[model samples]
Target: MDAMQMALPIVGIVAAAAVTFYAVSFAEIREKSFEDLEDKDFESGGFKPSFSSRQRRARRKADKEGRK
Candidate 1:
């Protein structure tokens, strides 16, 4: 009974520490995305590049040049 009682507080403390660590890590990651967005001008429709759009444009250009 004494051993179980001692173990209970130790377990609680460990669980609390784990929860605190995860919360801090999540907050840090969440802030990074917001920071990146803040650096861009959202009012100008935020010039974000898309990989697919670039690829499609290049393919169309190549096709057009090949036909000539």
Candidate 2:
């Protein structure tokens, strides 16, 4: 029941908490798959479809609007 014994357990618990926190963060950072990165880049940059495909889509939309 002395202060030394009391302090030992507290120190151990704190150390365990710090180690666990670091390990989880490391695993999370490592878990970012390449596919996930590509998806993020595509989302951030907006969709970059081929120019021909985009022009076709625009024409189709215009045609639909003209008939409306």
Candidate 3:
């Protein structure tokens, strides 16, 4: 047989195996689009401070402690 004829079967076998693997993996991956939203507690009173505000608070505390 010629080089082309001999290589055709090998290429086809590899391609078939790759396609089978991809199909199996895709089927195994479950869909996740039906989850409940998180419940927020309004009474807890959470504060989200800015970066500058946090730095200023830390600096003030350090200054007050250093003066003692």
lDDT of each: 0.92, 0.83, 0.72
Candidate 2, residue 25: Cα displacement in angstroms equals: 0.2
Q: lDDT: which candidate is best?
A: 1
Q: Using TM-score as the measure, name the better of candidate 1 and candidate 3.
A: 1
Tens-digit per-residue lDDT, 1-68, candidate 2: 89999999999999999999999988887677644655765656755556698889999999999999
lDDT by residue (1-68, candidate 3, tens digit) is 79999999999999999999998877665322111112334357643435698899999999999999
Better of 1 and 2 by TM-score: 1
Determine which window of 10 residues in candidate 3 has minimal summed lDDT.
30-39
Q: Best to worst by TM-score, what's the order?
A: 1, 2, 3
Q: Sorted on lDDT, highest at the top, how do the candidates line up?
A: 1, 2, 3
TM-score against native, each model: 0.57, 0.49, 0.43
CA error at residue 39 for candidate 1, angstroms: 1.6
Candidate 3 whole-model C-alpha lDDT, 0 to 1: 0.72
- Sequence-dependent TM-score of model 3: 0.43
Q: Distance (Å) between predicted and true CA of 5, model 1?
A: 0.6
The reply for model 1, stretches above 4 Å from the true place, is: 41-68
